[model samples]
Target: MDEDSIDHNKSVIIDIPTDLESNQWSKCWIHRIPRKLRKVKESAYTPQLISIGPFHHGREELKAMEVLKEKYHQKLLQRLPKDGSVSNQMEEFIRDSYKEIHGRYAGLSNNGFDDEDQAFEKIIMRDACFIVELFQRNDSKKESDDDYILSTPWLKKAIKLDLIMLENQIPFFVLRQLYTITAPHLPSVNVPITQASNHMNPFLKLTCSFFKDHIVKESDWEKFAEIKEIKHFTNLLREFWLPREFIKRRNPQQKDIADRKYLYSATKLDKAGVTFKRASKGTSLADVKISKKPVLKFIPASKGMKLKLPELKLENDTECLLRNVMALEQCLYPKEDYICGYVALMDQLINTSEDVDFLVERKIITNMLGSNKEAARLFNGLCNQIPREKTFYARFYNDLNKFYENRWNVTRSTLKKVYFKDLWTGSSTVVGLFVLVFTVTATIRNVYLRHL
Candidate 1:
């Protein structure tokens, strides 16, 4: 063969590496819902009104929001000093931080763009500015009927839900960086950073305000203030709801329990002499505990013993919110699946409409869906995309099962429910027993008299 042919053949054969470091394969936390999971409920995973991040950036349906993003960007520029021409400086900052911002997203390099660096910088600047402005608007005290998003209740609600989706997120660091530069320029009334440290770190207060309703207590926000690194809004939200003790106790390498058996439903537990009461409003949902002793003991004790459960407010948007959070946990923190564990526990407690009704009556659950069946379906559907695991409530489950299996407790509960349900029924039973005893005595006396 000629030299050219030989060289071509040699070039075609190349050696490939067989191994790589785990870090090389690592992916970012922001991710699309796996197709297998998304198929169960596509709408729950989708953004309806707006898209915040690259996952759904250029979809035709979401294009309208781009105009709004540009409008917000213009407003952000207006905040800067007119003589300084700070827009150029801001653009330069984005351009310089291009690689760092791009690295925050997984598989972004694979997506073909006309000019990747310019496109990325533009996206990051526009999105971060839009978010900073939107949060400020939400946190503002004064009412403005002229504002479109806040004035329309449904619009505000939709935007809030969209902002927390797993795929629809920008890195929290990026948003914080943009806010640091833009905050000083905003109107004095708009920026509420009175303290120096707070001025340096303003996003925390803005985020807390945006999620005020979910916060169980005022102190919860203070707890969040101590954390230095937050991945994104959804992750922050998950952390916010977690008990402080649980957060401290979490060990990523700890062994996960392999038990996957189903626990008894609320109604079944009730029938087995386990009563339910609402837990304190400030308690974390994951901190469900069963009391070993009865809450109350009268001279004549009640039939069933009670368990204190945390109150859960169910609304129309609850399912959507929970499903997205669960998806994020499943994808990002499978080992520390706090949200998943809580949902699994709820699933065990609520199997049917009757279980929901029992919880609603006990105030353990507030149903705003207008029907118990709807609430049941919402809970039952939440676990469809995620696999069941040994939940944090495993101890409660074991204790409840042991309590239910005791024959004496079961018998006592059944008797109390059947024979002495109310005061009138107990009075009738007592009267009947007295009359029977007297009749028997008179019969015996007559027999004795006859013998005499």
Candidate 2:
């Protein structure tokens, strides 16, 4: 072969450093929705009302909110002491922290404003300031009645959903830095932002208010005070929904439930003599348990067994919200895919409309999707792109399967279903047995008399 041809035949090898050896910044939790997953439901991953981060910046559709962002920025600055220096201070902070902010976004390209430091600073400052102002306005005491976004219910809801999208997030520390700078000038509420010792963080309070509908009141934000770093709004929301114990016991290296061969649906378990019971209000959905006794006294005791499921509030936007969170978990925390594991467990438990019905009747699932079929479809679709791996509820699934497989439990369930199919049938059976016994007694007595 010719020397040129020989050279061409040799493959060029480029060595990339391993995750350990690479000086690569930690995995930026913020990421664009992967196309494979996004194709399933594009709208859920895309920002509809407003875009917060660089992922959707400069899109024509989201341009309308640009003016609104500017207005909010001005309003926030207006709240500051009348000195012109506050704007300069904010600009300086953004410039100083620009590198840190840039490092927090995954797959950030240098093509857009990478060389334009001032432009990047402007975008971050404006976006961060707008978010802080929006959160501040959500609190009723500080909100103006005439606010355009707040006045329009649809817009407000859309904005909230948009802000929580994985693609539409800024690092939490960036927002916190901005908040710390402006907190002194902002109006005071029941909890002041300046009190670092207090359990209630102003940033957290703002986030909870913005997503109040999804948050459980039982969430203790005080525990979060000890968390030194939080990734972004999406991460915070995921953490908020988790049980305190789960958070404390969580080990990133621990293997999940991916090894279990079988997972039973609610209906299947019910037929196997396992009674479905709703968990307490504050219980994390991840804390599913199977036990011989009902976890809550309000739930009637049933023979054989009980399965407890945490309360999941379903709504029109729940599917969209959950899908994004699951996607984030899959991308950022593959080893500790808590959200993905939860969705996988739910997918197993809700394979059909019948399963949805079983959960709905027992109050284990609230079907806000207008139909049980729709709710079933929502859950069944979530895990389609998710990798099937060890789930968080593997132990619960394994234990419940063992209980359901018991021969005695199955026989008892079948007998109860057949003999006591309904009240009228059961009553008639009892009456008929009574009459037969009485007739037999009379006949025997007459026979004895005849013999005598």
Candidate 3:
């Protein structure tokens, strides 16, 4: 062999061991958006305001947050112990956590730093401290004049959107480690420090409080108590929307069965005698099902079977939030993709703006995205490159397909639309039918008399 080719082969042989040494799939949570998914909407997956982790660390557009991050880092240092041993402990913990997930960050550039681990350690500490400071500030009722992030309305909104992006995430463990060290020294806020310990993790409590409006109602904060582990912000957001019972009753080995051949839209489902109903209060987004009978058997209900879906509020930032969460599911929980399941179901049910309008009328969707078409496009685009091998709503989709296939449902739906459309139409149709029946009866009686 040529000398150059032999050297190239030797280098390739050495690199294989380096690759396998870092391949810890279980620890891999944070990930770059797969190219196919990113191409569908590049801006949706990219951070607009601030970059949080090593994936998008040195972007020019996000450079503004760097100075602010440093400021927060300095503040965190003042609160934390200055002892060399304590600092070393945190640094070692951060390093080990990053090492476990190093394979996920393999191709990422280290910017100007000579050593990759040194660069990431610096980035994690700064980002984690900033997040910790920001959450605590957001939780506090009183605001400081020097606090530019909270004071600037638009900036605050952008950061919230940016923080949840899959590409822009520090490992949750890093945040947890930092929070554990800083919580004791954190300045007292609205609540007494002693009482704050009542929560499973005071850090989690602060996070939930910060994002309460975006995720759930204030009354539902108690739900977080049941959660045991959180991978990162994106995962946390997904977890918030997942049904509590599903989490408790989930079977890791249980496989989902999807009928990919059958695709039905909202309008089509309606025509097939499926009555869309907004799920009752306190239901999670993952709580979807097809009910054969009405919720209240004694009370009269609409025609056909009922499909219960949780109410979805689509806002300006919802697309970004949902897209990132779906990316998280794609990377970490491919088999148990609850968020993707919900999105896929919605995409199937909303083929057009008409479907969006139909669901909006049923209160299944609160379209704040200005128009139904925009909401329809959002749902349609979400599942463009997503996989559906398994989903949380597979059984629900199967039930819907079965319900739609019944001939009786189509007949009932047709009857309701043609004759029983309104009080006047129904009454007139009933009277007209009675008249026809009476005429036929008279004719039959006359024929019998003649025969006698």
Candidate 4:
């Protein structure tokens, strides 16, 4: 810690132990986004996404989610905030959150959604704090009651009026997040049936298309084009225009469809999944009545999946926004939980804080700007006058300048400042940076001279 090496970090390091067992399963440190959920929106877009009415969002009925997902893959042609925060800040959050959940539950697989009954039952039951507690202590209905937990008065208030299903004890919060569509029908089909769909059923296709066409109908294509800088029908082109190639891929009774969905959803769920069924569902102490023949074999309908946004599942623009919000509210946890959260924050505050290269670049500029005061002093002078709002990139430029000038002696700090600096960027000090590199020949020369 040289006097020349001004402490770049304004705050002191809180050296928490990292001796926890290796979390090979966590991806907080890695560069991967989960597989996208391919949901279709029902009907038109509402500024406030009131389902407006009961509508289906089956993936086959709508490739909109898949379409929106593809757009996420495309460079965000435009965004409101434009700082990369609004669009992707949560993605990294999810990756790390998934990692923490996975590590916390050792030996669990990533695609744990498919076996939601057996696997995630404990997790959801334990984690569903408010609702689970209500069921445990308050619900007066016995397990033998006709409606069971549905008989609880708290449930009626907790669930949205839009939701008609009361039999299955799916968490109301979970149902809301899934964008479940419900009518006053006999069998309430709480969609998100399985993490991903088993079949792109034709009726499913009709349902999805109904929503798709309706959304597109109301879309102001001209206005969207204006924002996105496209020539015409950009909404339709980007949102609905099919990949002429999709027709080739379509086939009924393809054995692979079910397998692909199974494998893909399972793999995605394995990363991070929770069960719809609560732990208290089974209280029967009597000897099990194992039926040799099953009753038309039932698979869990409300299986959970990682909340991949509209981009991967590519829905209409509005739908994408809604789902993205849903994911953040549901899946993401506090940033401090993941290694990336710590590192990302460190990068911001330390390496690329307000005065991004304040310590290193100033030192380099002071040194490499040839002890010259012009660039270095001018930089410091500007920094002192940095408008609070402009300090972010201004400090970046200051360090970047030093990096180029004293490049030969440039430290890792310079590289980070010039290249990435996306971290904190909320810096203040325009300090100094100095990295000393010793060549073998130089070392030998010094040694020989000392001996002589």
Candidate 5:
């Protein structure tokens, strides 16, 4: 645990086919990355969480990646222009085929189902997995603890969660992970992102926790020792996704912005990071003294004593302790999905809309036909559903006493007054209501579970 030895085994290396000059890394990227990221540990640099922006930290990077991807797709179009030939005598045929595909896509319209929340979320999840995999093999880091790597998915749940993310990109990783002698052997695949939804196979969404002395909790770290799916994880990164850090650097920023919540672009390098105050670890629940007595942790609120955990509570008991504890499931909001899509739509609209004042002017969503109007509608709908204001230990609280008290009423009131009905009409209104209800329910559920 000594700070001096934290660099042990941290070197990493990445091999790529580069047509550029050999000295290019230093010239092109050295100034961009921080020193710590550039350090030659056992093999490569340690990975970092790619966050950006104030209220919406992860948005910029992912959005940039999406834009870059679309740009690449267009470039591909340019490579074989609408009239380009595939074979000696296939010029006309290929052009016709391209035209048909383009026409079909165009017919779908901008308001099509192409930009669903699930689709956007899938992009983020895949990108996260890509970053994880990039570090797993291409960039290996030395360990500070012979015990656990701070960044790797050493926990069973983390790994499984990542695998779920992986399925969106490289289906082969799933196949290989499932069949490989080493089940966790994540590998790369040349598969397209839209290749298969069947990749959701074995997409596990489990909610189980390890009790204080439970083996499942204790052994969560032990699973990483198994050298299983490194390759599978690696390839999935290389093919369909790029490192979060890569995308993070390219994000656009607002002028004159600075806030604790705001995450600026991230850069990786072989240098040390700025030493902010490390989160305090000695703050213990049972150690807080009450009435001049060292508290060894009693159930907060005498009522908690009556409520036993689900596994141990009685079924016959009316105000069942198990049910009370079980009622504590957390329902998470897909804030990223909602916000990302909203931002993208807003960007598109603001950038290309013929009329900017229409939304702020009439304020009638239905009457406003600009794409941004629909976008603003969707954004407000989701904004209404997500938990905006803060909650209190509540955040990372491990104990039941420090529970969450939601500020949902404020958010609800905001939604109620927004005049959503004006924006989404008829069938769209109904669908919006349904989605809003579902999102609210899911978010409440997620919070309850986490707090419980």
Candidate 6:
């Protein structure tokens, strides 16, 4: 080797120690969306009105929320005891462990703050308290007359969307810690608190309540009753909405994802004798199933089939919510990227406005976006830059593809479309067939008679 090359190798070896010392993979839960994903639809992942965490903390567009955050923080302080023990303790803890706090986010810039200064403490406390107070105030029966966010319906919804974005998050532990310290001093409004130390985690309750309207049709409290851990809002959303099957640890030896084939579009499947049914409200998005049914109850075997899909309510912020959760799965739980899998499967099923129209007609998709083409585009865009090498829906896709490939179903569907389009066409076809049969029978009879 060249002498200079040997020196370069030695320098590289020496640099490895410093890199290893700074790496904090264990603490990282908050992550920046990969550039590839961000480029697909940057607005989907970017916070629109507010920044909850350090990633987009100082953007000029979001600075307006900073004033409100400070106002909320002051309100949170007023809720605390005058003795100020909890505040002092939290401040000291953040000051001492600021590096640990900063390390929770991967690729976070220093932003010119060295160690835990007053600026850093203000940022952390304001952000954390702002969230807690927002939730608590929203939970209150009597909304404050002067409360700008709550009074403004559109702004309140915007803030909710902002909070759920992937980059706009702090470590969940920070929020919990702040809430735990202040819970005793704060008055519990809607949820009665006999003592501050209750068995139920009020922070979780409030968090779930805050996001209840957007994510699910069921009662969030009942669904997440036995909740144990949460990393952040994004993580909570992923866990709450993920299929029950993928919530558990995935088996590595499951079928290879490469072998998975995309299912036919909704319109195509409908034309192939497949019936689309909106799964019950209790059904998970990942609970998609393809079942074969007899055309008649009396018949033992038939080509009739049904595909059940859970109802999905798409709205203005639905893309943001889903993109962030999918980004979280991509970064934190690559192997168990069930949300990604679900969206990708949907992307396959929706190729055009016609497919969206079919699903909407079936009640499988509630198109609040107003246009079927827009809904179709949203589904198609979701899987951009999403890896397909592993998915929770491989088996489901395999089953769907197998069902679609059945020639009998296609032929039957074709025959139905051509011969029995409606009562008029069907009656005409039957009568024509009968006439042709009669003519053939008479011709055969006359030929036999003449031969005899």
Q: What overall lDDT goes with each candidate model? A: 0.74, 0.76, 0.77, 0.25, 0.26, 0.77
* Native-to-model Cα distance after best TM-score fit, residue 419 in candidate 5, in Å: 68
**How does model 3 score by TM-score?**
0.85
Candidate 6 lands at a TM-score of 0.84
lDDT-wise, the better of 1 and 5 is 1
lDDT of 5 by residue, 205-281 (tens): 01111111211122222222221222222222121111122223433222221112111111100011111111122
State the TM-score for model 1: 0.83
Model 1, runs deviating above 4 Å? 1-21, 24-27, 84-89, 110-112, 141-144, 189-200, 214-220, 248-260, 294-306, 419-452
In model 6, residue pairs whose N, Cα or C atoms come closer than 3 Å (at least 3 residues apart or on different chains), thus clashing, are none
lDDT, model 3: 0.77
Task: Tell me how far the alpha carbon of residue 155 in candidate 3 is from the true structure, in angstroms, after superposition.
Answer: 1.3
Find the candidate with the highest TM-score and give its number.
Answer: 3
Q: In model 6, where do residues sit more than 4 Å from their true spots?
A: 1-23, 93-100, 114-118, 144-146, 191-200, 216-218, 248-255, 258-261, 294-304, 417-452
lDDT of 6: 0.77
> Which lDDT tens digits does candidate 3 get at residues 230-250?
878888888778876766665
TM per model? 0.83, 0.84, 0.85, 0.16, 0.18, 0.84
Q: Which lDDT value does model 1 have at 392? A: 60
C-alpha RMSD for every candidate: 7.2, 5.8, 5.1, 29.1, 28.5, 5.5
- Cα lDDT tens digits for candidate 6, 1-452: 99999987875553232345754654578888877788799999888788886778778998887888998899889877789887898787777778877787776665755453566667787899899888888777575345789778888888888888888887787888888878887767465333321444767767766665666333434544444567888888877776654444434335357365567787887777888888877666666776778877887877587878888989988888889999998788787777787898899999999999988888899999989999999998898898887666676677667767888778888898999989999999999999999999999999999999
**lDDT value, residue 374 of candidate 6:** 98
Name the better of 4 and 6 by TM-score. 6
The number of clashing residue pairs in model 6 is 0
Q: What is the Å distance of residue 217 in model 2 from its true position?
A: 3.8
Q: Can you give the lDDT of residue 386 in candidate 1?
A: 83
What lDDT does model 4 reach?
0.25
